[model samples]
Target chain A: MTVRDPFAMTALDAVRAFRARERSAVEITRSALDRVARHDRAVGAFLRVDAEGALAAAATLDARLAAGDAMTDRPLAGAVVAVKDVLATRGLRTTCASRMLEHYVPPYDAWTVARLRDAGAVIVGKTNMDEFAMGSSTENSAFHPTRNPWDLTRTPGGSSGGSAAAVAARFAHAALGTDTGGSVRQPAALTGIVGLKPTYGRVSRYGLVAFASSLDVVSPFAQTVADAALLYESIAGPDAHDATSVDRPVERADLSRGASVLKGLRVGVPREYFGDGLDADVSAGLRRALDQMAAAGAELVELSMPHTSHAVATYYVLAPAEASSNLARFDGVRYGLRADGRDLRSLYGATRDRGFGPEVKRRILLGTFALSAGYFDAFYGRAQKVRTLIARDFTEAFAKVDVLATPTSPTVAFKLGERTADPLAMYLADVCTLPASLVGVPALSLPVGLGASGLPVGLQLIAPAFEEARLLTVAHGVEELLGRLSLPSLD
Target chain B: MAIDVTPARVRATADLARLDLRDDEVGPFAGQLQKILDHIAALEALDVSAVAPTSHVLDLACPLREDAPAPGVLRDEAMAQAPRSEQGAFVVPQFVDE
Candidate 1:
């Protein structure tokens, strides 16, 4: 029950303890970097380490504390946070874990990154991700695949695997990731941590490299719900920089007083998520958590999201369609890698062929074909309508329940290299997490317990769009009932 | 009806994407793309004529900015990123038709 290692402390507690002078920012930042240094060669959580920048920030916080600055406005003062490679971090290389942007340092910070600095969070380093946030596992990273810290043989589900691994491995207090589909939650579920995908446009995407434009969401990874809320608060808000950024005011549940109790809470258990393809460990774990919630005065209502089976198919079409258009800007005329050719068209082809990885190429082609002449209505257009039907399913389900609950991933972290050979198999990894993304609802995966393989199982809670506060509050109630999840050793 | 995923089709799509896919990539990409296409065929059975396509989930119109000059990346910074830069511009391969 006692945590002596300051690195193991959650971001919220660490910030408070550091502010109270119980620990120094420099020490916590140092502990964070030190842990990454020790285990990252095995985990590959961070693509690049910004030790010098992080240390300088930590030193500044130390000086302010020494000068007796209360740092009243900066709630995250002295906290170590990891930025995903996909975000544009000024002066630091924002690779997106693709060769195309391997050395492309952005001229400006992502709005979320700027806000993190404004709130006094040290930018630890850029975490690894699937190239263009396109894959379910970190294997698609043009860089090395990130290993699951829980079990090295397995993957830490991705495209945000590196972010999730960093938090689970105690390398960072919390890490920012983009969830185009299940990048944040799936990885968090597999790695044994907490991840929240804010409602679409909940957080600004000013400097986040575009993936699937409509589906992409900037999200967070933390070891605890309180820490997730704190991180979400630091970054979530309106930004004029991004036109899609919603102007809605942020409303976070007060996690201070153990506020959200399970009493009278109506949780909908989708029957579709519990059917075939549901792994035994995930099924057992979810059932156990629901029973605990029911015992603690929460009501579980069985509901059917009829269009659930079509989520993966619909997302693949719509996401790639958007990605094809969004990624068209990567021609040789811009930043990132370029390969010369005899003419304009040849140059573009050469550069793209040399720069992009396989998954990115596949998605671009799939998207292109979907939106191409004659096939548009059959593929891209049809997917969009099915997307509407899927969203309507949630709208109807929510009328009878507070939040929809399900498993984050169908199973625990599968063996690395297991599904890398099959694109169809990899697409199914996000099946449970895709419906929320397609509908633009706020959803999160809370660490429940270790499954049969001694790996983590996450219970997903999804709320209506712009209902992040309710989502987090209900998740907090579940977290309270489940208690702090004990993590696996790196050994 | 499932569209035939042929090597010719893969090449055609790649050309549209300006991908310049390698010769070896054609067959594999075709097979993989076909598998995905088959899976997505599940959507074809449902009649969605009554449903409106949702391009963006929120249904918010694009917030237009005034048509005025706004500050962006400096010329020097922008030029620095180009692989082939000339007198303050990007240099592209000449495409004078034969």
Candidate 2:
């Protein structure tokens, strides 16, 4: 059956249709590919579209379903899943949007990618991203910028911009994104979709191109919180390949039980997140969400996270310090595109000089300088101390409140090229989302309302580490109470 | 404190990193590096003497598994994208002349 409204169909609905044989997996995959063909020219969501590979995978899924197989054995069978280019996929060019590895094709899949494949999710293609997952907009990509589906002139937030945009534009039912200082949630907020960055260690990192190894996380973006949770469950768990992967049972989030009023749930609104620099529209949207929660039987408690302001400063230092070490592997020797030169040293210099884009080189230089021997104690060391205080702030806040709420970003999607020239301003775009990353908290970004410019504003719900289930439940409640139907039509 | 990423420091870092920079690049890179260092110098202003350092977010301790020969990508496939290779291994010029 042809899927004319694939964007409206939820993940659960897609799975049911596929299992009932109402629609073949090939048809669904083709519909998504067709959408990509029509919209990706403007949105720039995908770096590569594996038409032949996607069709082959869909054919296999169709065969499995036709053989009268039990659908219960595969939770995500026949679903289309797009992965950010940062995550490695066997034989696919995983560029991470950097020219250094432009021609690189991995021989193995990342742990999460392998899990998704085992769950029978079709690997549609790799999406665009900021080089090394650094920038707040996908414009940092060496290739092209991913435009917001809501307004083509505006940016889809980055470095997971392409993933969020693809799902928002109906190019894929759901997509995987990496969250390093709000890459996943910020984009989800900008594009009016569900993005979840699970607690640190909750998901495996094996084979994912490293940016800041400690702070980076793989997350999911979907049209609904339940769909994001479904994708999250399939890829989260212990993996021998990733030492940081948590050895815990997957906490299944059941949103189908219906949205229950968050009675007796204590929601904390951090005073620091609502301070100066927050746009009037964002503040209004967040306040409206909080008011809805209060009316729905949840207690809105005024909380203080004094360390929130230092998050941006601390993140800039720590992320780069870690990046300096992690990115050292990209020298001319490894498997990737290399620039030729007369000798070994010249080869290394030319490879890095020509291969990396401006943003990537800037970050590498900053990181290297920060970690240099004389400056290490003054820069990298101080940031680490601030990190401790940031984490402590969350630990204390969670003791008094079950969840924390804030505006996902200070403003709606800005016009492309607005802040591209100003690196510091681009960094500030991640202000509200960075604290959660620093504290290793589970956070979800869901659309609250439309901004003055008619773009969607995101409200972030945060819970203590390993509390993804509670976070999703609280988000689901807020989503129902808002009742502001802001979903855009892709047709 | 005022600091400059001078040509001398650039050369030092490039040597440490084993990269050769052209003379023309040295001057431009030095100016760019100086501006970045100036921006990052803000970190030095924070007071963190009593606070404990946090390098990683997870409270991880010995999460490593026992040593075993786990499956890995084949050597040929792994090296397929390498720019220069010889005798089934990546080739680099010798660091020191014989």
Candidate 3:
């Protein structure tokens, strides 16, 4: 293979190289580790680097490949994959970027992690994230904030920022990220990469650490649309372990149509998404992408989602409410950090107080308050009902358009600590991406172009639930139109 | 009614969630919570009486599996993770004084 930088190759490309005998799996793993060793110091992307573990896995795969084993034919064989710490990896510390589980080692692999191994992913240790997947910026990580690879000073938009940064920095060909709200897509937008958040029930949540059980979906990050499609196909489908996982035939993306994927497609441009607070650069990028799709024979239909304003409020109340319930397991007894106390109640209180970070505590309290007896009807109940309205808005919109075109985040990557002081301000940054998560529809973010600030901006495509193949096909056509974006060179 | 999120209310909520908030944390927590609650207070203007609560986006019936005994997490493995384990049970603080 003439490719000098094998670490920068996409997952599909790396697999092809392995088959062609152009590169060995061990060599690819070494290259990935080398890059991570060099750049992750500055980016703070990974919480733990399993250099010995990765090499051992790679060596095993290399032996299997050399032995002409049929197992080597699976999609992601030998491709280095960085997993978000939210998912359990047997023997690897999966912290979820929270001090509560800083040294927690899962005895079994999460369903998705095991599937990735079955499909031949070389597990490169756990990545950093916002503590308990609760922040818009990775700064909420009790360990350290992961910087955007695009610019050292800016955030790689979180709570999956570490996985996003790892892929963008060429530490791995593909990485897994979990989306609850805009965690996956927003970070993908900030760092010039493709992120796909499948429908809530499409991927199993068996081993995933629950943030908002109703909203969380394990997603994938890759450099291009095709790689994302490949990664998603491997991870999609139902698992009996996760009761919510739907039993449906997984449809692979039809990229053979190439640029024709856009022809005769109805692309919805929601006016509510293009409203105020959108940065000029992001607006320009969206406009350029829309105009190009139109020129490629796609019909741009203007529409309105009136419930958009209530989405953030609905999400904050609902997600935190679920989080408070989900996170109740971290009491001092069964697993993770513990603080001794004179009494049982004090033991629970002291353990939780010292273990959780500020954002997590705030959410728990907010959730507790919302679900409390007196306020339940006012806050939690009202939010759930409004959630129905938001979902109905999407159901109605889908009747008019095949896919919705919008900004992934209203703005590009912001500076570290920019919104740390104001939690509400930080919450507002996720406005554009939250609605898709709220409704549990499939959405993907593809880089539209770099903004005036010289950072990448993304165009989000929202498809109906379980319509990932259509979403990927449309995104592939858009990628062809935008050509290739030059990723950040951390030289 | 101006619903002020007072420190007393903050401590009560924290208590419900089993988080012991220090005195220094209560003021800042109250203010932040108030701002967030106020922002979400915008949801109050809507008449959602006709709407139903959505617990999950997908319409799904509770999946039932055949009730058969299956292997569960091994006791050794489960016990390996507990903070304080005595014999075969997780040891908690003394629930009642002798």
Candidate 4:
């Protein structure tokens, strides 16, 4: 039963319809804008919705289509995509959801944004996120928290909460999200959408506001694995602007391969990821999904990542350390919000003090202490060594199996302000997603089933670096077996 | 060695970070910092003396772009985002002593 509303269409469907001329890009974009007008007040998924710009672009595409333009090469033709505010969009404000750069607009598009436009995708708006992509829940956003579409009272797990929520709410067909630790996958799991964090160097990070440079990667949130793969392929590639982007060409995935491809697939279930901390309902859901795969002819191997408990601790230390340095550039003189003071020193201090949020301030302090004159060896240096050990764990595990499976998050979407009082509890949400990030490998979060609270549970799949095609192929198999999770009732 | 997260140390670190903290923020930050540090102390149990630090996970080194100047973020375009600017230069409080 089609909902008749264009917002109900997945990006793949929308593109096919556009190609068939069943619906104009204007119709699809207007439907999404209407949905945003109706529901965004409660969901808070978007920081800014570019309705006029989106419609204008869509109208242009419609006009070209009317002229019988053969746009077969454009896979994302007329698909409305929401960009995480952290990415630079020319003329549009890219806030990073932080007060520091609230009014900042980039002169040039991020490499990915430019690529998206090149692929015939219309950017609808900038989605909200945790301030500087620093928090596990969108509550850290200076503007407001993006509520889970599944239930308004709960969080859409975050720093990519708004992006995931936008896709889940059908406000945007898909969205670009950055994962540093669990930002993309964690939120994707909670919101019941597919979120893929490509290998660290797979996607260009030129326009993504530096969070944790070493750990940061841009990915996509969509209803289907195919849509996610489409967005992933478009934005991922080598760029001269970002030297860390791999020099190799992007290896596109054959998403058309169905569940039969799972036969003889060697799937490993890490014993460490299923320890005491995992929620019982989530754990059960993951087991049931794995059993389905096993029944489908995929082999499951039990493995261990002994340093699992150390991941969150290590991530907190290293991410903050990198952030401390990257954030030094927002010193009021170059760009963004600034506060006046009597002297240069006072100006720097005042600007930062007024601009940065509590969470950001806390991280800067933690990072500052970690990299200080006397303690660098014990804190920052030690974390990097531990990082080497984590990478080695992935290297050894992949030798035994094609992919590793685990829970995307320890628990389902927690109530807003539930873990806000205790910061460590909040940090622990990233435990499952952090290990793969530290290793610079690819990871995808797919909705396996729902938990006791009626919210979704996400099963994470990890692959070796540059094995995104393999990762998505396996994900496509699982998605076929699991079927699509129903959209949440927004009333 | 036991990590000491004293209020004085928190104050000093914030100073080094070029951030000014309120009187109340220092105490809370000191407590939270100590807790996070204590958790991070778990790393002390593992001996990584033989392991080398990984600054970047990718095996990339010195990727230099063409030195040729192409039109980049124009001065006016860049200045548009600046909170305070004058005549193509970012305006800031004087640093050198008069």
The C-alpha TM-scores of every prediction are: 0.98, 0.95, 0.99, 0.98
Model 3 agreement with the true structure over A140-224: per-residue lDDT tens digits: 9999999999999999999999999999998998899999998999999999999999999999999999999999999999999
The lDDT-based order of candidates, best leading, equals 3, 4, 1, 2
Over B1-98, each residue of candidate 1 has an lDDT whose tens digit, in order, gives 58899999999999999999989998999999999999999999999999999888896887877788878889888778777788898888887877
- lDDT by residue (A1-491, candidate 2, tens digit) is 54556556777678877887877889888888888888789889999999888899889889987887876867777678899999999888899998888888888899999988888888899999999898988998999999999999999999999999988887888999999899999999999999999999999999899999989999999888878888999988998778788898878775753446488889988899999988888988888878878877888889898878778878887887788678778778867767776777777777777777766665666677777888777778888888898888898988999999999999998899999766777887788999999888899999988878788889999998898988887787777777634566655
Per-residue lDDT over A409-488 for candidate 1, one digit per residue giving the tens place of the 0 to 100 score: 99889999999899999998789999999999999999889888788999999999998888887888789888878775
Q: What number of clashing residue pairs does each candidate have, in the order they appear?
A: 0, 0, 0, 0
Ranking by TM-score: 3, 4, 1, 2
DockQ (0 to 1) for model 1: 0.81
- Report per-candidate DockQ: 0.81, 0.54, 0.86, 0.83
| After superposition, candidate 2 runs with Cα above 4 Å error | A1-4, A484-486, B1-46, B64-66
Estimate every model's Cα lDDT from 0 to 1: 0.90, 0.84, 0.92, 0.91
All candidates' chain B TM-scores are 0.86, 0.71, 0.90, 0.89
Strongest candidate by lDDT? 3
Put down candidate 4 lDDT per residue, B12-86, tens digits, no spaces. Answer: 998999999989889888888888888999999999999999888999887888789787888888788888888
- lDDT by residue (tens digit), candidate 4, A198-306: 9999899988999899999999999999999999999988998888988887887776778887899999998999989988889999999999999999999999888
Q: Which parts of model 1 are misplaced by more than 4 Å?
A: A1-3, A256-260, B64-71
lDDT: worst 10-residue window of model 4 chain A: A1-10
